[model samples]
Target: MGTKGQLVTDPRAAALASKAWPYEEARKLLKRYPEGKPARNGQPAPIIFETGYGPSGLPHIGTFNEVLRTTMVRHAFQAMSDAPTRLIEFSDDMDGLRKVPDNVPNQAMLTEHLGKPLSRIPDPFGKFESFAAHNNAMLRDFLDRFGFDYEFISSASQYEAGVFDDALKGVLRHYDAIMGVMLPTLRKERAATYSPILPISPKTGIVLQVPVEVVDADLGTIRFTDSDGEVLTQSVLGGQAKLQWKVDWAMRWVALGVDYEMYGKDLIDSGVQSGKIARVLGGRPPEALIYEMFLDENGEKISKSKGNGLTLEQWLDYGTQESLAFFAYREPKKAKQLHIGVIPRAVDEYFQFRGNYAAQPLEQKLGNPAHHIHNGAVPAANPPVTFGLLLNLVGVLGAGATPAQVRGYLANYVDGEITPELDALIDHALAYNRDFVAPTLVRRKPQGVEVAALERLDRELAPLPAETSAVDLQNIVYAIGNDGGFENLRDWFGALYETLLGSSQGPRMGSFIALYGIDNSRKLIAEALAR
Candidate 1:
């Protein structure tokens, strides 16, 4: 637990900060999964990094975090050496549609198509070919906007193309071994009759979970009792069958020659199971990076099902993609609380890191987060104004203000002319204010004690020189709050935020008021007090 500016330099932090870390790790993985290894089975081998998507719901910020973080590592790997690398974004759309998502349309229709493969189910939105196709397209659209260069492979297409046929045969041949690994994890009843290969019902084309009568691995087929109690045999190839989730994960690593992959902390046990299955199938498992989950402000796990986590769209509305990327850039294994309120601070921190990255030596630069955020091609500098400051300006200016209007206001606050970057920030700030701030504005008049406190604050500010630093004004605000009978600074800050920004929290009052100007601050506070 280290705070900013605190010298809590540990050996682990030092090692991660070292320039040689990425290069050494890349070279090590190259050696571990060498080009001419037996695992490739005479196929051309590329250093593969895989990420899986479950298209049960719309892709959220968490999904973006996984892809962006993995891409950062991939970019680092490329910076290390010229060994060809590929990022495979896999979609598990062939899995059965056990339950319909509550967010989508046409719920009654989805209920009728339950138990079918997600790819086979009709799209609830009625715009795409299938439900899986719609979600996969959404995933592609977002990733493409980010300029990500990667291969997208869907499980439905892979199964139809017989890409996993060899893996399936291997699983069937060693069914007993896989069950030995999986059975212990299941309850007694489930362990009694669990099959690694779940064959789709030949009659209805629905994925079946019935008992397997026989595994004729020699013929590359399985006889399974379907939902209707009719026994049937299907070739475990070309979309006839799909391995269980854990088994599919392990098999994908071997079949695709994936050298590296990462997963959430909740999948730690599942990763172990997959690793065991991979080793059992005579393939070296991919190196793993298990990241802790992102929680909401309330400390509950962020999930698409729970709809508690902030979506990627919401963050982008308030901040840049780079800021969101920076949030995922550091200490991935540590639990991070992400919400709409933290956007401006994250944007500011990114600018701070960008400054550090630009000034640091090449050796020292590799350890900085901006290095990874920009994929080692960091910009020379950031905009002059902090996002929080710009946001505060937006709060006061009202969301309806035009970019030209903002440019006019900023011309006086900042020393130099408003550059193109500042112009862009103004646009983002106005959008952020409209989406997150303006609608929450408090418009009631302050009475009695609140009125007196505002007047006192306004009187104190009325005589201050325009050149007064933000720090000095901050002290004055604190004293006014204490003199106004607030228990502590936190409560006073809360009151100020509620009366001023119409939010429970906001940017530092001193910097905000200072940038807003002395006379303007007094007038604004007076307006609120007398509303």
Candidate 2:
């Protein structure tokens, strides 16, 4: 078991723990390969694969998630390892473009490039080589911005050149047996109307199977040729692809030289196949780490190209990148809800992970300078403020708040980057939108003080110290509480809440006074009472 943000010590804990993250997922991976069995000399390399989707449109959050999961697992191995390792993000741009996303305003521009591999799609914006190239390039940029290391291999390039020839042959060699298992299982489990491998035409909704034969299967690949014996395409050779997805998967574990891989429970039958294939094909299958599917909070899988999908880029533009990272990761074999509304809790969790742990392998990977700065290795010389503050600042500045806007309104003199803090606060404020009927949700009331408590606060402010600071303000709140009236002097609670929250139940009143400056504190209270 592990604490929140702690390295998981057991696999079952992956499914049981609250606030699950990368650690539990890592522990689950470890369980697949016991501590000392088949004791090899050193750590085996993990064969990590992100089934890169055809990126004909802007990539959605889930695609990023596929790679992100791989990245997280990669880090776990790195964190657990004594040396460096690598992971790859393979894109199936060779696959035909599926559909146009709503976010992209120009639908017509994408129509001409439908049947070809996404990489060959012409860039509508005329910025990249092709449509697939344009979308994937942006997505890759987005991923790289977050510090993911991926060696990208385009299926367009691979297939056209017959890179998987041997693997395709293997698939042909075992095609009948492979279909024997998959066809029945899929029919019984899912009401799937289509085969796992489609033979449909892109232009029309019709199935067509011309014909192809295995030309070769060697050098870790499978090659395909037309019935006329003209080389057509190639994949990793061997009945490898035919080994039932599970068996094929097991074969992947061996052929790809993968040490760890995770999938959804929806693929359980395939997982069963991977195990069978591992035994049939010799050696061990890669770790079978399963994660739950993510549905919108309302309960539907987030779909790409439907405009209904939540994207990582969209999430990051609004919330911090780290916030997106923490939320994207999870463990278990069920469905989890991920939507914009959960941003705050996710942000809060990320911060807590940073403040409470040594960051590396806990909060983030070590040696990332930006992550260090973000976590506050650079001491905060000024008083702390929330992200809500910065967001507000952005709004204000847009409406013409300047550095000098500092003294114009809400004017009090405490140091720090006021504008930035204001922006953070405003951004933080929008998080409550989850509870709203519209896109924008504002915090209702400032965190409340009682009339008597207000008076007490007033009286405390009378005898001002030469050096009023947060501590001094706190003392005043405490003093008022210590000497009070009636049934328990609600002044204490008010002071507590009002002090930190500005209405009380927050920081010490004295400290609040000091941190926010006496003027701002007094002004805020007065305005609150007036309202």
* Residue ranges of candidate 2 with Cα displaced over 4 Å: 1-51, 64-66, 82-84, 112-116, 188-255, 264-285, 295-310, 329-341, 358-383, 388-449, 465-467, 478-515
**Candidate 1 residue-wise lDDT, 1-531, digit = tens:** 234655434534433335443443454565674543343456555788889998877777777888887787777766645567899999999999999888889999999988889999999999999999999999898789888888999999999898888888888888889888999999988876677888888778788776564457766788878888877877888898887889999999888888888899999989999999999998888876788898899999886668788888878877888888888876787898988877888888989989888666555676788887876788886786788778877888886878877776666567787877667677778988888788887755665577778888988898889878789999898888888976677877777777776777677788887777888888789778767
* Lowest lDDT 10-residue stretch of candidate 1: 8-17
Question: Candidate 2 on 1-531: residue-level lDDT in tens?
Answer: 256656854423332342334445555555654552232367554435444455655566766667676665555444443334456565556555556655664678766555445665667778878776776787678668766777776555554465544444444455545555555655554523322232323234222223333333344333333334455353433211222234434544555555556666677766776665554444466564677778887888766535565666557655766666666653335577777667756665555555544434422333222223242242233224434332232232233334344333224434544556444434443433222212231222333335556666766676776356656666666666566543464645554343324321233345435534555556655655554
Global lDDT scores for all candidate models: 0.80, 0.50
Per-structure clash totals for the candidates? 0, 76
- The lDDT leader among the candidates is 1
Candidate 2 accuracy as lDDT = 0.50
Query: Which stretches in model 1 have alpha-carbon errors above 4 Å?
Result: 1-44, 213-215, 398-404, 415-420, 434-514, 525-531
Decoy 2 TM-score against native: 0.66
Against the true structure, candidate 1 reaches a TM-score of 0.83
